[model samples]
Target: MTTVYAAASMSLDGYVSGPAEAGFDQLFDWYGNGDVEVTTADPALTMRLREPSAQVFRQLLQETGALVVGRKTFDLTDGWGGRHPIGCPVVVLTHQVPEGWPRPDAPFTFVTDGIEPAVATARQLAGDRLVGVSGGSIARQCLDAELLDEIRIDLVPVLLGGGTPFFDHLRTAPVVLDGPSPVIEGDRVTHLRYRVRR
Candidate 1:
């Protein structure tokens, strides 16, 4: 069976990105600085290590064998940098397939509007491998479409008063937690894994 997983970093106040997704945007300028700690606790992490929580969860996402993203993120990512935090099939959900976006050498296809369509495309592309949902709007679309099988959130400690949020301005049904597992990475961040029940 094909499984869909959505992973995100949320804050203590339930804001994943912040006003218009600013928290994540703030990270774009992280400048590989090891001094700024982005996690629940101010832990130690060198440039050698990205976000500990992201590293661990990215490993899981790699298992997906395929990934889907929205055009905003894809275009921002230089036409979706190859395979993401890992090298997996990536399908960008967009109406416009811009030229000269510096696409990765790897296989990166484009899907039209909607998350299910993207998931369907990924499933067809993945064959028997798992599918990953990475990005804000795409994830929300998945949730709205009820196509996501699971969601893993790594609650970070950073505080961004405003930005794009993971779960915002969407009407979602009741969801329960599978459980909580803790992961500590080189004193950088502590990741709490939660199984999101559909």
Candidate 2:
């Protein structure tokens, strides 16, 4: 079965990014803090991760066939230079498609309807592989819509008092999760996975 999951590297204070879109170095330190090299679809970007984190990262890259992200994230990364590091098709949820987009060469689908439609498009693209939902707002929407199957967090030991949160503005309160089942400890981060209990 294909799984729809939300994953992000967050600080101890629950921030995915610090004030003014800063602190990514601290939040994503695990990606380059180790000696193991992992290359992505983008030849220019490669991750040097610890053994444990490398294993988890490899699995995510292999399993995720498509990703759903918000317009904010899409703009922030400049559409990931037209090719996301994961090397998968991307579904961008927005009210309007960005200018000069829907390009024939890009494997990106702009869904203006809503998160549900964006996720549905990603599901079709993913086939039997996993559908990854990114960005705090998008994840919250998926949780509220009951479309998320799992949550994975790379918890970094840092205190970013104010920044972007991995989970926020959830309409449904007290959402229960099953387990952080198989916790994998890495150099400066702990990889936690939980099943969203419906």
Candidate 3:
């Protein structure tokens, strides 16, 4: 069976970016310790600390067979350079399809019907592998539909005073989670894995 999940870098205040923050670079700088460019740090030391998480991230990319995202995220990322970063099929849930989208032999599938169909198509493409759902709106839709199986959040220590949040407009009752307590803490971030209890 394929498992569907969402993973993202979030701040202490639960915002993914600051208001009017362009491109969310600050929210995602922890991925490569890119902010270190402005601070004093040995290149070798920085790579040493970042290597472990980078390896794990690569493994996840290898395991993902398909990705699902909302139209907003698709537009924000410019459609991942016309190929998904995971190198798998990408299903976009949107009200209107792009003019030049679904190009010949492209890895994208635009679904305007609804979220359920979009996720279903991703599951079919994923097979026994993992289906990655991203963007706050799409993930929240999955949560509401009870289609998500796990949530992997990289809790960054930064405090984005205001901006888009990780979870917004969710109406479902509290969902139970089963995983190791305390989560896995790294140098600059904490990795949390939670299995969604149905």
Clashes of each: 13, 0, 0
- Badly placed stretches (over 4 Å) of model 3 are 34-49, 180-182
Off by over 4 Å in 2: none
lDDT against the true structure, per candidate, is: 0.65, 0.94, 0.78
> Across residues 37-96, which tens digit of lDDT does each residue of candidate 1 receive?
333111332233355544664457457778888888776867534545445678888887
Q: Could you say which candidate leads in TM-score?
A: 2
Ranked candidates, highest lDDT first:
2, 3, 1
Error of 1 at 149 (Å): 1.6
**What's each prediction's TM-score?**
0.73, 0.98, 0.86
Query: Candidate 3: deviation at residue 161, Å?
Result: 1.7
Lowest lDDT 10-mer window, candidate 3?
A: 34-43
